[model samples]
Target: MVKEQKKRFVLDTNVLLHEPLAIYSFKEHDVVIPMTVLEELDQIKDRKKDVSRDARVAIRTLENCVGDAPPDLLLQGVPLNHPNAPDESLGKLAIFPDHQVTFANPVNLPGDNNDNRIINAALYLQQQSSEQIVLVTKDINMRLKAKGAGLEKVEDYRTDQLVDDIQFLAKGFCELEGDIWSQVSKVSSEKVGRDTYHTLMRNELEEESFYQNQFVIDQGDDFCAQVKSVNDRQLVLKDLSRDRLMSYHAWGIHPKNIYQGMAMQALMDPEIDMVILTGPAGSGKTLLSLAAALEQVVEQRLYDKVIVTRNTPEIAESIGFLPGTEEEKMAPWLAAVTDTLEVLHKQDESPAGSLQYIMDKANIQFKSINFMRGRSIQNAFVLLDECQNLTPSQLKTIITRMGEGTKLVCSGNLAQIDSTYLTAVTSGLTYIVERFKEFDGSANVYLNGVVRSRLAKFAEQEL
Candidate 1:
């Protein structure tokens, strides 16, 4: 009896950008590239700002691997007829010689696009040879279509798997053991006020406490953390000067809706020097952080100014040059900040006058992360938006910029990260949240259930 040969697989264009190294993912199996895939790569060859350029480079690298090989050995260009019955050039390359390979365009039987052509080629090859064929794609719709078209196997490019069992530390409490609790109790009576004491009590589980916002430090074997409740009463943390802590408050901000109470409690902390907010898009991470900064700067006068900056290291492509001055260049990125400010202005009694007054007072400064290299931010409310895009090195640079008496809040959506080198599990936001989990001076919050338009939320889930 003869042994059956293993199946071959063909990849689509989008799969490569979604995962650049997908070409090498298949092991000990034959890989085929229909000629149409090369044409798609050529169309995106000159795209400088998009990941398409990276896809082009990947294809070029593969081409170099096949350099000067015999036509049959290389699976070089093959002729295939399109649905329009025109002979078109499609490159064919054999990744494995022991397996039989053939390429031909299938009949354009309804709902056929460039991707369909590639699938049809695979189908034709499967029928011609004894080996089965599988289609790999990142396009969900394309995958479904390929299945409906009678392809035996279809799979997504899964190189970008998120870390399993990942949990955010936003809304939970910690516990401490007896020894750790005794140590904390001793320090609680020092410069810390009553609200801080109570918050620590609420976060303390036996002997453990939730420190900062993100960390639940082990207080030895006997302690744990617990969340505090105020019986419908919101608690505000008083400043060291015995003044009410002020925060940016505005309507239509989603975090204000879900995280307002927690924000209030966090701001009351005298020990927490940094806070991190992570959520999906429209979850109000940035707006809430800004609100807290504004309150500290304008109302409490705790900070000299509010400094807002973002690093566009990931989405730097197609950001385009800003017309006119540097401020104009920054306007597009600062649009969200302006929108939040406008909302705050509308809530004020004298919208125009109050905005101008705040501007004149130098209470708010919008700057780029590039300009933050040599600066030490002291006695200010500093906000870093879109921090998920920052590489770990870049994030470290931003965090180290904090000067004495300064409070820093870094906010970004882990799911919406555009950085090719990072994912929700490995992004700087996750790294910070995990690393700072034990620090009493830091806090982390993850906002779920986006408060954007009803349709937007639906699209997020459905899409």
Candidate 2:
């Protein structure tokens, strides 16, 4: 009988950072770590920076799981490669004896980079063993290089799948049932006060029925106190603040644009402590969020200040070392923020002083991700722009900074993530939407059509 051969797999540096447990992912199969890959891991692990902290943690976790190695030998297994090696030199290392393991240094690779060396090592393994060899990495360019070099079996270490639950709620409408009204009323008037009524109105419920208002509700009972509504094309907010209602109409936003209308409703919702907006490039997520925030600070006087921030993960190349003050360093990325603010200012018919006066009184502040740590924001309208660049952990950090009576508005394009480790499904914006859908204090809106231009919408669909 011919024995079944075990497949051999080699991992690149990114694959390990993405999923350190990948070594154990393949059951009873041999895993190879090229010398160059180890060198790359060592460099990342040695970095003394905040950004590399997570990478260091990953390395430590992997090392803890798979013991230490010998001083002289580059590779070690469950059974020592050399039994006669000194006990002090041969540190404890986990090696699988049932699997045949070997290391190779490929002499001739097109490039001397770590990625190329990994590919070459996999090729060498394939040539030496009867079993198939698979190369695993999270780098898109490296995967392409592997394929171009005639390595057919390459796989992405799918850490991106961990956050897939977020994508399911990206474009869906949540239902608030009929019986939640009574339960809400049972809470103290302060707890379920005017904000509760505002939530109901924004949900587009019938003004007549006590429970018919379309809003988020927290009910103590499972069956009797439930919130339910069918997903509809148009979202209507009946009793919004006058300023917000006027601003929405002025911006040419209405039920005619269903998705934008829904997003507007969420933005206008006073009861919701958190709102998440996700869409593509031309969806007007930023403009709508800015408009709503302006209305609250300028007219309603509900919050003490308006705080705007963004995660500026570079789109392609770095913008280079910016030369300026803190605000100047942020100016380029914040042009869109200022543009929206200017539009709102332009709509004001009063003298020029009115816009400046409002800005001064409301304490409007623009911030970047660099200054967010260790700050507690209170009674403020906080806008997290371009949140798609944030990881789930990073988003959690930002959200936890919200203080009492503060409302957080997060907007992003799920399809346009700029972070090295994040994608549509794995971004913090999508993460919040999925986890908070059932929470009464949270609302999500997905804007579909582009409001930028007719040509832009056409380009979005066709190109």
Candidate 3:
């Protein structure tokens, strides 16, 4: 068999910003960084934005990889070495001087923008090199432009993407047909404390194995249970009352569907450290998360304070120009929490007073995702909203900030992502939902219905 020649990958700036260590993601393939990408990173590194941190990290990563090489060696290529894989030889890292490319080529882009310059670099390499030259970028338009410019291969940077399609994302629950007992040939039942537990073979359900903390409900039957433990042979299910789950209330807010019921149950459970909610807009994700936070902080006194934070698109660079304190600056983006509060207390004799009372009682603090780094948050009910716009690395930064006794509730609409470099499958919400589905202390729920309003439901379904 003929050994295939190594392909050279020309990375765009957004790929580095999306994942700072993206250079190592291509395995042994040669990685090329166009000077245009570096120049763009340099310009963005000084900006007062959350992405600036990523830009700085990407710059530092390039420095660490090829900093010590001489000019000729840098142009030629520096050997890429990683400590974890010392035994395996890796590819070389090279910096392409795209700005100096003045030769006329038929496939060259006419524009002088950074994107065009990067595409031109790939074009130059494709002409000069014998190996396949592929342009890797996160921007879809750039990919199209690269392909249009006659680049043989153009691809998206998908090393961080855990799923290819959004349909396969974990829904936190599985609905079974008919009664669960009808499918099970044998079962072992026992009682622990006030909860009833049943153990059956993994294949007794006649479906895929369930993950820990995943809920199982009957389609037309009254059976409802949660998987407390899962082994290779059998699963331990905690029998739950369907009526009881439907009756669960958090700060006077009751679940309208079994999905929300499971979400509320997970949110209110003291044993659960993280709860992820994903669904369409008006699916009660924000409302349920806020209600659960308020219940834990004010009514139940399980937590000291309620810290409501989110990845605000505007807050990246314009937050400094906003008026008042950090919390006040975050007010506009966090209006969903306030709106939910109003709905929760609309029946009060003094709605305004009740709103203020709950706000003060819960000690709610609106925080920005940019300011959440390097701080340990403990004994707080954290509601992270609009997380669909975040990347996997960005979400990891926030999740790692949680200290002891912190309960994090992440809610987002995958279909409503605002990030240009992210999609429903690559969103951080989808990443965490899939990553944490098997964790015993974490639970995820995809709210299935639109409970906001009739008009909103119609819009969500039709438009």
lDDT score of residue 276 within candidate 2: 84
Best by lDDT: 3
Model 3 off-target regions past 4 Å?
1-5, 83-89, 102-105
**Candidate 3: worst-modelled 10 consecutive residues by lDDT:** 103-112
Instruction: Give the candidate number with the greatest TM-score.
Output: 3
For 1-463, candidate 2 gives per-residue lDDT tens digits of: 9855666677777666545445655545566666676566778775543345446655665565455455333244442122232242222223222122233543435654667767777776676667787888878888898888768699876543545455455353433446545423232221244432222332344422221223322222232111332233222223333233234542333433545655676677688799888777878888887777777876788888988888775521333366766666677887888777676667677736665686687777877665787899899999999888777667777899999989999988876776786666656677677677667677777776888888988988898
- Looking at model 2, residue 348 earns an lDDT score of 72
> What lDDT would each prediction earn against the true structure?
0.59, 0.62, 0.89
lDDT of 3 by residue, 89-187 (tens): 678899999988865656689756999999999999998989999899989899999898888999998887888888888899998888888898999
Model 3 lDDT at residue 363 = 95
Clashing residue pairs in candidate 3 are none
Question: What TM-score does prediction 3 earn?
Answer: 0.95
lDDT of 2 at 141: 87
Cα TM-score per model = 0.51, 0.64, 0.95
User: Which parts of model 2 are misplaced by more than 4 Å?
Assistant: 1-10, 16-35, 41-111, 121-134, 144-153, 162-169, 174-256, 315-324, 349-354, 419-422
lDDT of 1 by residue, 336-360 (tens): 8878777767988888787778765
